[model samples]
Target chain A: MADRNEILGAAQGAFNADPAASMAAVAEAAGISRATLHRHFDSREALLVELGTRSLDQWAGRLDEVDAEALAASGDAPAIRAALETLVLGYVDDADGFGFALTDHVILANADLEERTQVLADREAVLFAAAQRVGVLRPDLPPRWFGHAIYGLLVSGREAVRIGDVARRDVGRLVLSSLLTGIAQPQNQDSTP
Target chain B: MADRNEILGAAQGAFNADPAASMAAVAEAAGISRATLHRHFDSREALLVELGTRSLDQWAGRLDEVDAEALAASGDAPAIRAALETLVLGYVDDADGFGFALTDHVILANADLEERTQVLADREAVLFAAAQRVGVLRPDLPPRWFGHAIYGLLVSGREAVRIGDVARRDVGRLVLSSLLTGIAQPQNQDSTP
Candidate 1:
């Protein structure tokens, strides 16, 4: 129990580095015997579920730090935009550290996690609706689609960083700008170098 | 040898349906014995590489259909935007079909496939550069980041369709719009409901 958090952290690192990592590999990475790993997590599925839950918890914690409830009700576009930027920056690190947990098929398929994720999505819906109301986010699409788009962008941003296409320091800004305005140049903005 | 394509198709479906699926599961999905699967690919990694290669071939074929080179050299903003829309729509189907091949860790780690992927990416860079030059795409980021963003958007669009968040018919437009203009409400666009 005492080493559980350490084990999960090591396991997450191993999984992110190689999604195909096996239980034996995870045990080795966690500096434990297979017996001990099994003792902590009866199966790979169990471990994945725990990891997924932890990732969600961390995500929820981040949202709380931004006072998501207050932001959802604020109707203050500038404040909401600033909070959104902060959230995107914070999520970049989460995307890097908890990539597998957030995207794993097993975690996605798990009913409990799916329900919990939906709850988070619902919370985000409130925030997005508030943003839309305040003109911070686009109103043409459903609020839920915003959540889906961010998920894709974050993963994409992380991949860009990993592949050396975008600098790590620049990814958060790239993702936020892409989310808020997109990649198309405005008509008024001159293209001159 | 004759059943090879059929086997790969089955394996692709199985993997997309469950990334954690075992070789036995893949063989079962392919309607073949484990021994036959091994005889065909020798290992799971080999099968993934073959799938990834086939997906790249299909992607290349799609790009050819659009006359990518001509578009890259055309420097026509409207034409480039239309071509980009067509490409995004085509890729949504590919994302739905060849998803695992596109994002599988084994395929991503394979040296040969990475080289092929880079080649495809370079081709995309040319198109993006032309778009930027023509003021179709924003000139603020590298052309390669555009490719990364689209990859993320396509995957996200597919997931939206799969999870019933966005309809199949709407995913293409949603992805294109998100990529081009982003999700933020246009400043001049009326938000009145």
Candidate 2:
């Protein structure tokens, strides 16, 4: 079998560029022959299966990078914005692997995905709750809803970048702005601005 | 093949309740034999292919329901909020079918899907631009970003509902609040409330 890191790097490159890229192309990218690629991954689906598992593993680790208590201890608006920026950047970097893993039935159908996602959400919910308690988050909104909204923007911005609607670099602000304040320009009466 | 409507209704019901529902379960829900279901859809893949196509077609029609000109001419905030609610509810009702269509390769891979999405986005972009022109939508945000954000929330909220992370009824406020103003509550000065 080929080196896991080599194959994954190549496969991720292919997937990031074009999620539909053939396995043979991935092999070539990895400096391996098609036969070697097949030896490592019996089929395209198999490659994606590995990609899904690894992607989640990496993603699970990424969530821990955000220090929730520090964020909560800090000012609500700036802290929440910074926290979401961290999340958005992390998601943007791994958009391809995530686009594949988060969307496909093979990835979504995994028995642990729901639990794993909950674990992540549960962590973020603490931040949202703390932000709300400080009166930074809207009182009418649920604490967990902020997490979902940021996540929505992440995936949506990723899809936009994938379809060439916007450049990858451009989506960071777009996602954050939409998540933090919204699209509406504040009126003179609006204070946050 | 079985009746298209009967099969679609049952398939959506099954998928909404349990996205991983087997074809046999879908057939049973439709009051059809497994053999009949197989005749109608040679495989689950085939069913998703059909679902993807139909979902986009339905989604395309829903975009026209919002009237930008009328909204712009009237009061901005509440009207815009009301209009968005209409779209959100329509989407929530069909969230399951959409969860499958919008995310899957079959739907995304369709050459027409991208064009169809752009056309819908183009329509909503007009509303965003007009709303900004009316001083409701944000000035710094690109007009098209509004469409992306709303579309993002729609799909994200749909997926959350599919997974039972939050009740479907709860999503309307969650989405609108985040999209219109943001998740953060105003502290001392903001008066939109």
Candidate 3:
């Protein structure tokens, strides 16, 4: 059982790095024999199914901790940053789980997963709307669109970390800065605010 | 030869829509016999190789048209917007070619591609630096990081379009708005400058 959890973590990391990662690679990553891995799981999908089960549980807990409404009500950039950080942390923990959402995986097709995802999306919408009303979120950005962009970065930032494009610690800053401040300098800030 | 080009376009479209798309599906997309597709390219890799070659040529031409130096010197947001639009246009035309960049493929491993990608990145950095120095881009951003986000959006926006998450026409606006203004409302407009 101890080895099982370890193998799952290693598989999550390997699959997150490359969807096409092989069973041999997962076994190698887990520091276990291929036969031992075979004893635990029949195929990649079986491993993924188990991982998916854990993923849904973990994701649900993370979403519960978000306190999105409170953050939105605060309407401070730092508060939203905290919320975004929470989102990023989820990626750091189990990016492979998030990757499943991006793909046509059976995990996404799960009824429970679908409802949870919608719940999360709906919460994000409420938060963004509140923040926008308070003037922290950009007015031009549609709430749904903002949600997707955040979702995109959440998935991509993991790939960046896996490929050594960005350091693990830098993921938060990179995503938040890009999401909120954007790359274009504000006219007000360039000269005088 | 013309039929070959047409088949390639169809394959790109099909693959962009679903990377796991089958040969039969691709043939239907091309409006040709399965034999025709097979006659032109022995395998998906062979087709991808030819597409990769064409992709490199097309990408190089698009980057050249960006006139990064000119846009930077102008220090105009709209000019930068135009350059960004040029990028989005290419993705709309051949998303599968760009998708090759996102995934690990022989196309990415090719030396010519490696060099071309470097060239494009270098040009983009130069443009971004000038824009930041001129106060058109966010000063806090590292120019290269900004370029990657823009590039990421270019590839992902196409995926979004193919998945029907966004309309084909919305790709340009979504990428530009997200890159330029971000999701946060400008402080100047929100309350006081």
Candidate 4:
């Protein structure tokens, strides 16, 4: 059991470092013989499933860091923006593993994994609710739809970084701004004035 | 040459239909032998490169459909949004093939392919310039940044549809809304009621 835990942890680190790293490399990095790695994982798909579970656990834990109360108490726009920034930056830093996990989760369509990801969706709903209470988010758009939009932007931001079209640091801000004000300038209103 | 074109076209079609479909399946669909497919593509990698080129061609053709003069006349916001919707929907319909192409492109990082994709960047620039002229887009953000955001949203929307979280039909609207107005709601005007 301890060996399995060690192997899983090592695999997670390697995935976090490089999503495309070879299995043999992971075994080596984990300080396990290739044969042992195979014995434990049996196949790349098996290893990925195990690794994805661990990554999901980590993602869930990170959500705890988002202070929902503070966000609720403070300005809705800034707070939601901060929350998004935190989430995107956290994912960016651990993109190697997170990216791989997300890809595998999508490909596998594992129900349990999908259920776990709902944690994010739930968090987003909470944020949207808060935003709506403040009259920042359009009431016409459902919270679920807003959550979907947020997820879409995050996914898009990550891809932009991968394609070298946008720097990793700027992804959060760019995505945030695009969601808030949209492309059209406020025609009649001058909030600052 | 005609046979080769037929095989390539078939492969592209199969890829668009299902990303995981094997090259052998594509060959079969084309009514050709696996050996003939192998002779034409050499490998999956080669087949993907050809597909990527074709996808780029298709994307360019879609951009050409955008009425730049009309867009410039009717306020940049509406024109650019309409054009983006058209472009994103085109990719959504061909999600499987484009997703495979994107994954392979990232894994291989082919400089030649990268060079070809620049045409997309140039096309996006024209759209961004129009948005700027109409004063809808934030002048602070670079046109390239806007392009990346749009591209990212399109990719994410495809992934979202694949995961069954968001409907495929609504992806264009979600992406468009996020691009125009960010997550935050607009604040009250200081100068007017």
Which candidate tops lDDT?
Answer: 1
Per-model TM-score on C-alpha atoms: 0.91, 0.82, 0.78, 0.72
User: Candidate 3, residue B137: CA error in Å?
Assistant: 2.0
C-alpha positional error of residue B186 in candidate 4 after TM-score superposition, expressed in Å: 2.5
lDDT of 1 by residue, A1-193 (tens): 4399999998999998887689999999988899999989999999989999998998898889999889888787778888888887888888888976656778888999999999988888899899888887887887889888989898899789878999988888888888878888886777634
Q: Write the per-residue lDDT of candidate 2 for residues A1-193, one digit (tens) a residue.
A: 4597788878877776665678878988888999888888898877877777777676666666777657766656666656656876777677645665666665666666656767777877777777676666776776767767776777788777776777777887778667767766666555221
Provide the global lDDT of candidate 1 against the true structure.
0.85
Q: What is the lDDT of residue A133 in candidate 3?
A: 71
True contacts kept of 2: 0.57
Candidate 4 local Cα displacement, residue B124, angstroms:
2.1
Model 2 CAPRI quality: acceptable
* Candidate order (lDDT): 1, 2, 3, 4
DockQ of each: 0.62, 0.45, 0.41, 0.38
Q: For model 4, what TM-score is found for chain B? A: 0.74
Every prediction: chain A TM-score: 0.94, 0.76, 0.71, 0.68
Task: Summarize candidate 4's per-residue lDDT along B30-57 as a digit string, tens digits.
Answer: 8988888888888877887877777777
Best by DockQ: 1
- Each candidate structure's count of clashing pairs: 1, 5, 6, 14
